[model samples]
Target: MRSVRRTLRTLQGDLARDIALVLLADGIVGVSFGAITVSAGLPVWLPMLLSVLAFAGASQFLFVGIIAAGGNPVAAVLAGLLVNARHVPFGFAVGDVLGRGWRRWAGIHLMIDETVAFALAQREAERRRAAYWACGVGLFVCWNLGVVLGAVAGTVVSDTAALGLDAAFPAVLLALVLPSLRDKTTGAAALVGVAVALVATPVLPAGLPVLLALLALPIAFVLRGRLDEPAHVREEASCPSR
Candidate 1:
């Protein structure tokens, strides 16, 4: 159909470039995750499996770190789940773009940070759908492939952190959120989030601090609501009756 062709063209053009950048970032971070996981004595196939199944970069790192530290597997799973709790809200925010029926099943696997950010950046429904799928599937493939490559190379590259690969994941996230920082409310929320995370980092166990940072969200929303109410009341009071 003509609609399908137009969609495909848009995907191959604008979406492809954005997805390519995401792919490269994910690939590098995936490689770092793979190498670090292997260096911690995990089998190469383990990380490759995680890349396909688990697929969340932060949670995967936390899982691997906990295991490597001789922490309980149960604890690792709990921590990973806690860190990934943000996806619950993310699923709600982009539910429309997730498609219907069996397609929703596929979309669930793709519901990570990058895909969510890219989708939200779009103003139009169709473009948001396209961006989500393109970034999600592309990053998934690239991440897995990089995992395989890095797992193999782990034997040779014992010092993955020395190569500065540790910064890749946060860098990608920063890039995604930077645009939204231009807005005052978003910027304020970000500052609050950073402050909360930093303060909690020393007191809480690895992943818990990030989860704690999410407390800023409700606070920001409530504050914004209160600020809007007075202005709304003032505007109504200023209006003259006919």
Candidate 2:
């Protein structure tokens, strides 16, 4: 109980405000998801189950959409897996914030884009740890809670789209990462990722393009390293060693 209290105490000020805003947005989207899924004639348990099991908004929505469209269940699962492939890098990036043992495992389960963004946004290790867990646990609760409420009210709100809740997730995500883009390396990486995603979107399946955009990170990093290398070192490397 004290540990939980300590965690909550640390999650104050701007970080707390940011987390609250993000949670509100995600909760609304979660509600939208539940309402839409139920309205599409899926069982009330489906969205709640996916929230706990998958915990990924985009992939879950994709799965529900595909399944609702008469897509094969196997295909829907595969699509969800493909869409979630982006989490591999997220895991790598967020490994530092997650401590050890059960906490690490729980943190991994909560390793969504928003939690990751908040974790990475913080400078100190303690702050990052607090932000990640606070956002993750809060998100898990709010998402599931919202789903429950939406499921109960699903019949009343047959058209979740009319609420414009879908825009909240992406808008909040963009806001979270936009500040980081001011850095040259970060900006270059983002540009490369956007270009890659845009180019691949036409040719690849819905989720594969985003996964392919991860290629941009390495490309940008390599380019940045080359550019930042000393001219003398480059010339020396280009010449034969004695």
Best by lDDT: 2
Off by over 4 Å in 2: 155-164, 226-242
Query: What tens digits encode model 1's per-residue C-alpha lDDT throughout 13-68?
Result: 66678678768867877777788899889887889888899989888988989999
Error of 2 at 11 (Å): 1.6
Task: List model 2 lDDT by residue over 88-173, tens digit each.
Answer: 98998889888889888888999898998888887788888889999999999999988887877885545546776567667767
What TM-score does structure 2 among the candidates reach? 0.87
> lDDT of candidate 2?
0.85
Candidates' TM-scores? Answer: 0.82, 0.87
Candidate achieving the largest TM-score: 2
